[model samples]
Target: MKTALIALTTATFVGTAAFAAVADLDSDGDGVVSFTEMLASYPTLTEEGFSAIDTNGDGVVDEEEMTAATEGGLIPEA
Candidate 1:
């Protein structure tokens, strides 16, 4: 049980770290992620793909959008 708990905790930490890494890519610190900023981190992602993630036609991906994309497997699970 202890081992499982430790593993869960570690996974949570790693997931949070990954999210933070992506969040840190917001060079402008606009509280939202722009395509250019996301592209800087994920070179393989295209503008169209980013559009899908943006979800609200806002031209930016906010934290809720990012979380939904990640959770729904629209983006890779971290």
Candidate 2:
């Protein structure tokens, strides 16, 4: 029973980590992740999608915006 519980816990942790990795916005394999990269990688992003990512409303995506977008899970996985 203890072994089973440990296995379940380990599985849950691994699953969570995998999901987090998938949700990460750094899809381009580049050191600096951005919403533009996300859009390029996932072409399904529309104007609304861009708007959702441009948290600062500067009309351009920066690192902070990208980080926010990534943390918010607004960008899709690579």
Best by TM-score: 1
Residue-level lDDT of model 1, residues 2-76, one tens digit each, is 999999998687667546755786789777789888877777888888989989998988777777677766663
What candidate 1 gets wrong by more than 4 Å, as runs, is 1-22, 76-78
Alpha carbon lDDT of each predicted model: 0.77, 0.64
Off by over 4 Å in 2: 1-38
**Candidate 2 global TM-score:** 0.48
| Per-candidate count of clashing residue pairs (backbone under 3 Å) | 0, 0
Alpha-carbon RMSD of each model? 4.3, 7.2
Query: Candidate 2 lDDT, tens digit per residue, 1-78?
Result: 999999999867755654454346456554343546556667787778878877777665655556566667886655
TM-score of each model, in listed order: 0.67, 0.48
